[model samples]
Target: MTNISPIRVTGLSGNFDMEGIIEASMTRDKEKVDKAKQDQQIVKWKQEIYRDIIKETKDIYDKYFERYSKNNIVSKNSYTSLSIKSSDESIVVAKGSAGTNKINYQFAVSQMAEPAKLTIRLNASTPIVQQFPPNASGASSLTIGDVNIPISEQDTTSSIVSKINSLCEDKDIRASYSEMTGELIISRKKTGSSSKLDLKIDGNDNLAQQVANDNGISFTTDGEGKKVATVLGKNLDADITDENGRVIHINKESNSFTIDNVDYNVNSKGNAKLTSITDTEEATKNMKAFVEDYNKLMDKVYGLIVTKKSKDYPPLTDTQKEDMTTDEIEKWEKKAKEGILRNDDELRAFVEDIQSMLFGDVKDIETLRKIGISEAKDYNKKGQISFNEDVFSKAIVEDSDKVYKILAGYSSNSDEKGVFEKLKDIIYEYAGSSDSKFTKKAGIEKSASANANIYSKQIAEQEKNINRLIEKMNDKEKRLYSKYSALEALLNQYSSQMSYFSQGN
Candidate 1:
């Protein structure tokens, strides 16, 4: 049999290295996924920390506002007081006068107090003049002596009264309608010693003339001789002036006054003078209420942070774990112990003093001892403290003011940061620089140069590892493939030799 050289083993090296390439790719992919997961965890922790800080700060602020509102100390300015008086000379005149011989007379009256100007309008359709008999259509008409006077359809007694009221009502004037007596009385809304109202009427009509002719109804020139207005057995002062300059000034304490020879009495026994006593009492009550509410809040916050459950308690679910991780839960606990509960010696001393004053109880007791507050048994494992809420609440009620002083003064000292300020500092540290200066320079030449040195070292190490892995895999693949190929080639050569021999035979 003719011998044939074994087929030259060419292009087999690359095929042997395939396993190394696949292993390298898998390692790189795993590293990327691990980095992503780590980044996500860091972000979640950061959010939790920030949220806790905000919750603590809000709790403190809310407590402060609640106390302030309860105190009733609003921040405004302006107020006013008012008094009123009427004429004593107010009289209802009968419709007809006796022995009226067409007498011409004038009636002029002035109010003791300045009349507040007012406008009066007609009340429905009451006729201005009273008629003896009804007309054919059930309408009544006025009859002037020796003349038939047709009353205007729109004319009414209410309208006439309204018009007269409008003319007389001024800044100081007040109007009241007397339905029982059908009298429209005008008075001063705010009466002083010098206040008044003036009314005048001149007429030739028999009825109007007779009413004006009566000396009691008309004001006279002589101040002492003029008619005196009286109401409720009190004399009202009244002075008539042609120039309308008359006014009645009511004395501060006096409740009686006169207007145009009329007497009027005012009742002012129930009026209360402006005093600060009510305000002071209200403020005191508010402060007391604030103390109570503040105490309750303090108890709640302390309980939430420091309370602990025994290990026998059920294990927390995933959701419970997430909730516990929140910043608010963590922050409240931190602040209760470190912020408000810090400087226990000073706070307890103050609390003791307040308790002594308010409850007459003198006991040398530290807050922790009084309230059963203690260092958590598993503080290291759980990151929490412990306190008895019932004990804490009792302590708060016993000395509310002391508690308020402690909480309000918690962040007052700028030298040492408050709980909120400390939390802010923590947030700033984690969030990194708020400025964009570093971000802008990230890929610059100087940055790039620095990064190049570091990256170069890292790249060298990574490449070395990658290469080693690749080489190792490649060698193993090559050995295995080579063995397989050699066996196959040998089998083929043997088969060819056997066939050649058979053919020769």
Candidate 2:
């Protein structure tokens, strides 16, 4: 027997829109799905806004709070009072400190320290196998300084250079072969009058003699009747004598030195003078930058605390969007996300906690106002700071230490602590890490993304349930169609039988 597919009847079975009835009946279930979707969208928007606040707070902490906390602002102030002028800058450049007295010093430089170097020339046509001649033991050994490095006939110039460098590394020496010059150069690491580079062949290997002949390095007795060896290196010692004939010897490693708290940069031999003068520019710039960052963070806090909520706008449902235009949907969403963090009590309290530190009632320093930093007079400014240049300049010039201590010190008591410590503690509580209040309350994780895991899982479960409910509703619609079809068939059969009876009469 052939299998026949069942036929589906529509309006022929009943004078009713069955599709419309099914849609109307399932409206409540569809609403549940739409509400869940809207809720998920809201959670996502909230997570994003919280993450933004955390990020901005962290940025302010690192850029402003951390820098000002550890730094000695008093030292920065003193740095402005120090200046130096070199009469012959080409010969010697100098930088004076606050301790450097105004004085002129004459100096003469005889020599600069140099690293001892020996470059051994090699024949370009020489074969690698013959680079190291065989010793009495048939295996060649090259002795550099005190270490003996074994070499084989198969070793190339590069390999020999590597062995020499590696074996004699502890002797504060390095060896390399210059491909351009076809020469092997050995140099000492340290450079001073006491520094030395001694190289001699221990065996009767022709390699050493070839190396010596290739380079113009020779050992001879000096006028003092002592054996003196000379290499191709230059400027091993930096020698300078003051005008009073006091000699100063230095290694060639650096061209600068600090004496009597005054730093000197040696260029050539000559006289240079240094002077210390009050320079307010550095202190002024630091204070200005600090104020700018302070104002920015304060503004952010004000927005966090004082922003008003849009109670009229709730997240849009799917059905709601279908009836509305694209522009309307956009407008609705903008309003919905306007007040995710508006008037948050905890965040407002945190802002107030940090703002209280700026009141400035430290012991001797008394107040930030005394140091020329004061809050803006306008209530609309929201605790933003302003600086009086003349007042600050006078304070900084007279007593910078008191200003620094007031800003940097932090005690358990609010009276002793500064803005830096108080702000540090507040930011840590709300925006520091995964344990922060913002992270916990919003159910947000510390990640490169803003997706809240808790809400995402909840949404996934809702979607699953909605799908199952939709499938059940569709099944109920099909069964209703079958029930209606059977009734119609029975009614038609009864009508036919009644006609037959009437014709027989």
Candidate 3:
């Protein structure tokens, strides 16, 4: 019977709508299945709401705890401002902290540093074959400072120069030969006392001497014939003097030097001065921004904790929603979701803990109120913090170092971590770790969602059973029709026989 298709036999002889009657009888059972599906949907809505709240809280945590908390809220350079002036900036320039005293100096550059070079000028008639040491393994190897440059016997002077420059681009050295002078010049790239060309050859090799004589290099010492001017591989020898005519020691390797704890960097010969002044305006602005961000986060969290729960509005079912419009459904769900996280103990405790930390005492400063930061006095304000500009600015200007430490100090005790660090600790406790409150709640919601899925599957199975039962009912109705049709044929034959006997009488 299950293998056969259920016949759709209309009530012909019985004159009745059997399918309609069966549907009316099953309406109550169908509504029970629909309600189960609606309950699952309500659970899904709850999971979504919890997830959104967690996401919002995580966003706040990232902004405050991750980005700005670890930094110095008070600007580092805000206490002392340094101004620099150079008479000849092309020669020298200076920037850095100016100590308690003013700095004044006059600098001069006598000469600039140079690199060592060997320029070889070969005659056109000469056979320019490279002179390698007898122990050299091949005619293609040129070793310089443990670095080997491969060369060929057929390589020309120009090609060798190009190869040397290419290979030594990263080696802090370069080689070039002038076509007009026919000189091969190898020199260090930088000009300083430390920048010296390290050129060495085998003791048996006389390549250096041959190149020097061929390149017209003078080897005559001082007082031999004439005074020889300074050459490459020598430091820049310059005399810099202060206003007191005292010699100031300056090196070619660094442009800047510290005098009386004040640093100065000069590129050209010049006179420069450094003056120190207080910078209170910038420090005040930074303090203001810190207070503003703190108050904003505080307000956000407080509002969420105090949200009112509406017990009258339960999650709407599908049947209930069918009679309502889209806007009506939205408004009803909004009220239903009002108290999902309302008066939550975890959130309330977190808020209270943060407030305690903010209002607590710090080293030297004692309390935030002493630094001109205090909570709102109004009961309706919900503990929003306020900063007095005059008092806070004066505190920063007078003792910025102390004020800075009070807010950003590192401490193992929660009472000592200062306001910002304490808040950061609270955020990490709630949202930072996988086992934190935030993650644990998300896990609970996830489990609830899984349970809702099981409900959905159960409801689906019930629906399949309902469909099977309807098929069986239709099959029974079809068999009843077959039996009624046979009975009608028999009755009609008996009535005809009775009429025939009456006619014979």
Candidate 4:
């Protein structure tokens, strides 16, 4: 039996040992980095899911409150129509009663019917005090076209008129000399509502006085002008009248009112009692019109909630996807129904009584089933509820207040948890740390210091792993070096013996 002596292990080189330690440290660092990345990804996913739930829930809540539950069922059309004709010229007619009043007048000229021409001339001989260009307040001497005419206190009308006619003889702005009063009467050749024939003055310079003296012509100011009226702290046109008698037409021009043989002065801010009569037929018509509006709204709500399939139908098209989802539709219907259902028992009872009064019978769920508002099985054996819109509309008309109460009560119970509060709780449950085994193992902390402690532990764990790897690598390297050193020594010893043997030989 050959006895093998154990070889003495030698120390490892610094380069060999240090390289192994570095490689082991690098491996452990890479693992920690990967784990951190995965942890971050998990957190991100949790946040995203939470956000999506909150957003979808909020959208459903807003649609329920803003679109279906709001009160907006009032009619606004209550009026009567009237027609009038006139054959006179420049005659104003006021023809309408306090209720359902209207005014229609016309002006006719026989000369306008034929192709006859009329001429009116304007002559400006003496300068008139006219407002300067741009600013109406500045006073300046009148200049017709390009010639400047001067006005004196003693200037005669004829001389001034002659000067004006000579300067503007064939201009479109014609000036004709009047021999009756030795004056120049200025008028436009064309006469229309918009024709500029009135004299323009500088502020309160009294252009009438200037024209009277300069042309020796007498003129009178038109008494009719724009009139203003006010009612309920709102300004309105003085001539406007409510033909239907639904709205009170308060005339601002009528400031004096006789009350019990005593006169009272009313101003813009004051209120006056209108003793005008109303049309009962028109009022009823207006109320009936509101019924139509209410019906339309109810139909819209029903359509959104109810789902139906066509017989022998094809697959849903892309366009169908644009419609509301089943979940959304269900939520909307529930909200609508709730809004119509009043929470207050008294109000609910009152609405029910009103319905009873209108329909002569209370339509409960059983009654609705008898009237074709019950569940029915389709060809696929799936159950679905069908609504009777006509019956539902009659029910609504009979008891609108009941319907209103139901709609106003939707998703508004005070006892239920608020959406925002629920969302916050969900977030807290998902993100918060608790004193549980799973949380502790996952390195979740209750306090800020605990978080810091966890981080410190992770760091220490990483360092310990690195150190263990270094120790393992160092042990392997030491064994490798020791074996190689021993082999090298044995080989050298054999070489020396061979040299001695050769020398001896």
Which RMSD values do the candidates have, in order?
24.1, 8.8, 12.4, 22.1
Worst 10 residues of 1 by lDDT: 73-82
Q: Estimate each model's TM-score.
A: 0.23, 0.59, 0.49, 0.24
Expressed as tens digits, the lDDT of each residue in 1-505 for candidate 3 is 2332223322233444445655665576566555555454554554455455556655656654454343235223332233445666676555432122434556666554555555545433344444443334434445444455665655677677777788877887788777777676777776666665543443323554675456445433334231121224544545666557788666565445555545555554444333334545555665676667666656655776777767688778667899999999999988876666667676677677766666543433246766677876754446467788787767765665556556655578766665667666776776565555655554334444333443345545656665666566567556756655566566556555554654555
Show the colliding residue pairs in model 2.
91-268, 113-235, 113-236, 113-237, 113-238, 114-235, 114-236
Judge candidate 2 at residue 484 and give its lDDT.
56
Question: For residue 248, what is the lDDT in candidate 1?
Answer: 30
For model 2, how does the per-residue alpha-carbon lDDT over 398-422 read when each residue is reduced to its tens digit? Answer: 6655555556555778556655555
lDDT of each: 0.35, 0.62, 0.56, 0.35
- Model 4 regions more than 4 Å off: 1-29, 61-395, 409-505
Candidate with the greatest TM-score versus the true structure? 2
In terms of TM-score, which candidate is stronger, 3 or 4?
3
Best by lDDT: 2
The CA-based lDDT of model 3 is what? 0.56
Prediction-by-prediction clash tally: 46, 7, 9, 15
lDDT of candidate 4 over 383-479, digit per residue (tens)? 2234454444444334433333332222344223322223223323322334322122233324443343333355556556656755665675677
Candidate order by decreasing TM-score: 2, 3, 4, 1
TM-score of 2: 0.59
